[model samples]
Target: MEPGTARIAVDLLGGDDAPAVVVDGALRAMRADPDLHLLLVGPTEVADALIAALDPAERARITVRPVRSAVGMADHPSAARSESTVRAAVTAVRDGTADALVSAGATGATVTAAVLGLGRWPEIRQPALVATLPAVAGPVVLLDVGGSLEPRPATLARHAVLGAAYAAVAHSVVAPRVGLLSVGTEAGKGDRVRRATDPLLAVEPLPCGARYVGLVEGYDVALGARADVVVTDGFTGNVLLKAIEGAYAMAGGPPVGGGAPRAAALLGVAGTVVVCHGSARADDVASGIALAAHLWRRRATELVSALLDGDAATDRTDRSTDTEVRTS
Candidate 1:
């Protein structure tokens, strides 16, 4: 709820429920924050429906960028019909019509659209989808949730730096402890990728006073006793996050303090982006909107980008010295 106005582009046909859920979430966000403005991007009828429902005074705060195509149409429908509303939403951000974007559609679709639209930062081979889980101690940042499915050791190491910077800039965690997700806490545990990543992270420079805490197991994720930032491959992280959500349900409910979070912040992109669980409810959508607002207000994306640039500079210096030694 910063004083400045934040225009968020809502993909009216992006979620599982499309216009209905999108409208509901938009209303909730509008009511909660007076400085928020929305640019609904989807079918004209759907945007009109929402606008018609709002009072005259509030209507001015909202605008519509109609995308006539239906939600789940066939691929390559046509440019007017071919491109998805999600892609259009990304275009809005690129063109500076919107400050951020939020979608609950397919993770792949959103990631693809954002990457193609905003362009990835230098040295970021694969963008990361970062999720912040509420821990008893504080918020724990998890990355590669669905962005990089099979990242190499270098990608994993880069994500660690990204996660660390995000935790500090987004959540204000001082001296965040970062951990590589693995089967055991031992140094040599987990698959080849994890094993290789553990040592790389140990020596990699981290931002915001963050330090690498070696390998951590799944149990550590929930307990939050070991690390404040957990890094892993997108495939494992995605499955693990969903499994924890299911486990919380089986146990009657999430722990009293906080449960598994359904919304995740998409990092490595140049915009303030949030991706909700595809099966998100109205409340989940609301939460995602709020999260997007929070990130934009804090200037989280810009700050994280600066941190990554610093890390890249460090990596370059290290590489130059190694090259010099070899030449000498």
Candidate 2:
């Protein structure tokens, strides 16, 4: 949608019904965005079929990077083979052949490939996966959907900062109110991690004019009345996200605006990467490609990193002043 050319590398063998689903999604994405250029990473035949589906005018927008292997859903992320399609796509972004990448691969494999290829931001022990849900109020940003399953309390606090910055930078949320996901809205309502994370978020220096809103219930995630950005550990966030999707399914359809996205942006890594559900449909894959292009065009990754850098500098100065006062 943005007014720039976004060259995206797509992993064709990353989904449950890959190559076919991925090819269809890539075709749909190419037609939707005139300025979108695709670097298809998969078997040569699959890429050829997708490119052949387009007219001559549209065909110029496509390129192919042949990769045969893929990471299966059951494979350990650490076992991601060197020749996997997801890894090739990561290489394309790292090599500047593509501005971003989208994959319906195993979330762990995608994250692992992106981190190893592009490197993570400083002090980011674990990168987070952020999803934007179209809530009743507006868009609600949720982080750690499936990045680090057993994150420490400190990681949750750090993710609060990431979520807040992402809401403002990516979604244009003003003065984003951030919340720690818990059983209730009370100050100390969750398990050990939430209890520890609440105090940290209360004092953390959030970027993009954001503020902490204490604990928020599960309903707040869909309603968006209590917070614009919700933070939690990856395991809980992943489960909650899937449950919300299931609820929308049981109800006939999603609410007016949209539902929980099948695609999530991987934060803390250096490159712009989108990870879709392993069971993604063609439209879901298309949306993932579009999301990657949107982030690249907006320079969302760079801007978010800059916000974190500013916060870090301010924190260092504050600490220095405190030490000076004590010594004086």
Winning candidate number (TM-score): 2
Candidate 2 ranges beyond 4 A from true positions: 68-83, 316-328
Query: What TM-score would you give candidate 2 relative to the actual structure?
Result: 0.93
Tens digit of per-residue lDDT, candidate 2, span 1-328: 7889999999888877776888999999999999999999877887888978899989999999986454243353423432388889999999999999999978888998899999999868999999999987889999889999999988888898889889988988988999999998877798998898889888787777788989998998889889999998889889999999999999988888988899999999999999999899999999999999999998999988877666665644485543333222
Residue pairs with backbone atoms closer than 3 Å in model 2 (clashes): none
Please tell me which predicted candidate would have the highest lDDT against the true structure.
2
In the order shown, what is each candidate's alpha-carbon RMSD?
A: 4.6, 4.4
Worst window of 10 by summed lDDT in candidate 2: 73-82
Please provide TM-scores, in order, for all candidate models, with all chains considered together: 0.91, 0.93
TM-score, model 1 to reference = 0.91
Computed on alpha carbons, the lDDT of every model, listed in order, comes to 0.83, 0.87
Task: Tell me the spans in candidate 1 whose CA falls farther than 4 Å from its real position.
Answer: 71-83, 315-328
The residue pairs found clashing in candidate 1 are 42-67, 78-82
lDDT of 1 at 164: 89
